[model samples]
Target: MKLEQVSETTWAIVDASTYGNVGCIKLPKSVIVIDTGMTPPLAKKFRKLIHKEVGEPITDVILTHYHSDHVFGTQVFQDCTLIASSAMAAIYPELLNNRWSPEGIQELKEYYVQNDPAFAEQLKDLRIITPTQTFEDSMTLGKENEVHIQHTGGHTAGHSTVYLNTERVLFAGDLVFCQQYPYAGDQTNNPLEWMRAFEEILKMPVEIIVPGHGPLCGKEEIQIQLAYFKKLETWIKAQLSEEISLEKVLQTVDSSPTPPYDLKADPRLKFSIERWYTFYSQDEG
Candidate 1:
């Protein structure tokens, strides 16, 4: 795990060179970790890295969403209060334990371990972790220090983020990703709603933003991400008017908007485009 200084109290643990979303952050009064890495070994390595850097254990662990990649790491920080959106907190157990899950990520359920040798043995033997506390829309933290935790759901039903009022940093979770187009596969992903949340983020006087996956970013990146959502709106509108196919839409999209990365191989693009189309088409219907 590599750490980056976003601000005075804000630090990010970058997991790998590629798909570096497996990271966390430390605040002044309490430390808030973003998504846990995809498995136990990665999570353990992450904890060691954090302890080495902060010189103290994690006081709080926030799982942005219930994806196996994110939640499997929660077990590593049992000493801290496991936090997540009420919706996310509720959905994790069945999703983790049951052979069948709604998201249908059987490959991640079955073969992610194979892909990452670290996950090979650890994940198979882990126990279920249901969050002790839950919140509906928004929550606060560091009351003595006036820190805030905001829930801006869109990517998933229970997707949430942390906003540290002190450092003016926002942990965007999966609602906003860096560089690549977003993954909107869940039933709760409303492009319109997601776009609004993106817009709302602009209202905060945040200096830095930490994403669930990828690098820690600044204001310009936030605008770029918001623009991506807005572009989806425009593209989806074009599709509805012209009755274009998904492939045609892809072809029409030049420059890709997802810069510094080739999103063609990423499966998230297909689902993201589909969700974007639905948001626009629903209005016509």
Candidate 2:
């Protein structure tokens, strides 16, 4: 909910510990939103803040990926042009029909209400909103390379990262988890490609980075994240030779090849290990 102005035209909600970082950029005539918050109420609050403080109506909302935390709040911005990767757009129907269906959303509300009764009313009338615009590779907004959106899949098949050409600020989405552990278990994720994306990022002259779920950082944090994944891949490859059950593999990984990064209380170590194990196991098989 806290906003920090990164540059003259860029501002970010740096409180990813509370929710995914939402941001807005000033264009020639209007503002472009980076990612909406995880829920309707949160998104509404962000929309109102942009208008109140930024003094510009949101003309476009560029989603980094299709993760519910990033895209689920798009309904509030239905009036704006919603943009995403073609891969993310392709999965919208399935997400709407199953994962983000009204029934599925209601179930989530019920689970949260069990812990906090006041959450029930806040989740009312929640619905999925798919992107209206999509691109296969890269897209530019405004003139002279001010804003650039490029499809960079590693976190997910359709994930995209935004780059501000003039400022050298990259909105890395889930590709860079900053100081925290990243979720690496999605069926669409490509860990090797994700690592390659890191190398590409290092090559860039990004002065500031806005990660999907962490604080504002620089290239060193990206290096740490890359190192973490490499260590994970090495552990998975080492275990691929063992003729053990998946559960046993999980247990063994849980105990050894200690993760190279700082683990939050809810670290994705088991999930990352399982995902890499499955990926490598298929190759070995």
Best candidate (score: lDDT): 2
**TM-score for candidate 1:** 0.80
TM-score of model 2 vs. true structure: 0.93
The number of the candidate with the highest TM-score is 2
Candidate 2 lDDT by residue in tens digits, 1-285 = 767788778888878622778888888888999988777888888777777778687898999988877776788999999999998789878876886788777788888788766656656667777889999988999777689998888888889999997888898888977667788878777887788888998999999998888788999998877777777777677777666677888766555555445473445667776777787788832
Each model's lDDT: 0.67, 0.80
Q: Candidate 1: which stretches are off by over 4 Å?
A: 15-30, 93-119, 242-265, 282-285
> Across residues 153-254, which tens digit of lDDT does each residue of candidate 1 receive?
678778777777776878787776676656776655766666677778887787777776666777677677667667656757867798887677766555
**lDDT (Cα) of model 2:** 0.80
